[model samples]
Target: MAKTIFITGASRGFGKLWAEALLQRGDKVVATARDLSTLDDLVNKYGDNILPLQLDVNDRAADFAAISKAKEHFGSIDVLINNAGYGLFGSIEETTEQEAREQMETNFFGLLWLSQAVLPVMREQGQGHIIQLSSVLGLVTLPVLGIYNASKFAVEGLSETLAAEVKGFGINVSLIEPNGFATDWAGASAAQTTAMPEYDAVRAAFQAGLTDDIFGVPEATTDAVLKLIDSENPPLRLFLGKYAQPWVKQTYEGRAAEWDSWSEIANAAHGK
Candidate 1:
């Protein structure tokens, strides 16, 4: 069945590809960005079926209004993709307090509010899907991108809890974990490079590492997403590319072993 889908950060990158893909599958898409003018091709291609709107997920009021408007336009939202996020690449000591807060506000708090706004509607209707665009870093932390890791780690935690909470409400929550994609996420959307002199070598190495040669095709991930979205038994977490699978597996295994090793102390601390 063709459903109504709302995707944030639809102006470019994965969100843009997803919108086009969904529309090709005969679904109605409410594609939004901070600036709707950037969605010219979509508007020209699928005028009525694809509704373009201006949305800044960080703004609670505006987001609510946009959802309401989309509901009025498309009847109801069957799938909500929280894809509006950026990479803040810097060490913990280097990233300012303001930058950290902004990072959480956009990646964590903004997602929370949007999910909250959509919950009531989905609950009343008795079915909905919430998709989060998490990173491979959500499962594994690396040097120099501590703040970005923190934000995604927070999402992973919250999304896990939300999956359990909304199951009874007939709502589904899934996290999309993608590795290095040929998207502007690391290129155009990257945070300002600060604390340069302190970690010049590491910073330079990191910059040199982000190349399109290693990135996977965006369509492959989007195609996997389409399958995931349509599957009757969709996983709570979906790893997009082959590059991410090994990392996700290793992270889970390593973390599990570490936790198990500390289980005795953990239980003792809890007075078990």
Candidate 2:
């Protein structure tokens, strides 16, 4: 069966790769980006199989409209991939309040709103898949990326709850946790920090370390995504790349330890 997939941020990076891979496999893709002009290559190559739409998931109305157009184009959307997001790098003290909000608006709330918009159609159809693009940082907080971590953490929480809630309704939700990929996610694509003298020390160290780790081979993650899409029952969480595995495991252990430390208080409060 040729599945129909609507992917946000399809102009570049993992999103574009996924769209191309899916189209190669005979699936229909509603490829979207804030500027459709950049998606000309995809449109020219795949033609009708790839419906390139201009969409900024941050705009609620535009998000809904894109979904609606995709549904109409393909008859129905079998998968919704919320891959629209950018990394905002800065320390808690250095990052502005507005920067933090903008991060959340696109990374967290945008996913939430798009999922909500697609729900009615999926519910009526009785089966659909919602794929969220989160990062290894979503599981663990790293210095100089507090805001990005926060957004991903919120995504993790949202996907977990949404998965359980929608499972009974025959809808599935999954999270794709990829570590640094060679996508244009770094360099020019990354959000620049509003440099602060107080954070100059860590900023220098952070940039150096991050630059080295940003060029991961994206093929590994793309393979993982193909396997997930083909599986009869995909795992709720899929970790990609060597860098992602350790950080995610560490986060799991730390979270477990924290919960155990507070178990007594939690049980008492619940009258256990």
Best-fitting candidate, measured by TM-score? 1
Q: Which runs of model 1 end up more than 4 angstroms from their true locations?
A: 205-213, 260-264, 270-272
Q: Kindly list the per-residue Cα lDDT of model 2 for residues 99-208, writing each as its tens digit.
A: 98999999998999899989988998999999999988788777788889999999999999999999987899999988887777765567867777988888787767
Runs of candidate 2 with Cα error greater than 4 angstroms are: 211-215, 254-272
**Candidate 1 per-residue lDDT over residues 1-272, each given as its tens digit:** 99999999899999999999998879999998988888998889888999999888899998888889989888899989999899888777888888998888899888888898888889988999999999888988778889889999999999999999999988999999888888888778889647868788887888787675668888777778898789776799988777788877887998999999999899899864
Deviation from truth (RMSD, Å), model 1: 1.8
Best by lDDT: 1
lDDT of 1 at 123: 93
Alpha carbon lDDT of each predicted model? 0.88, 0.87
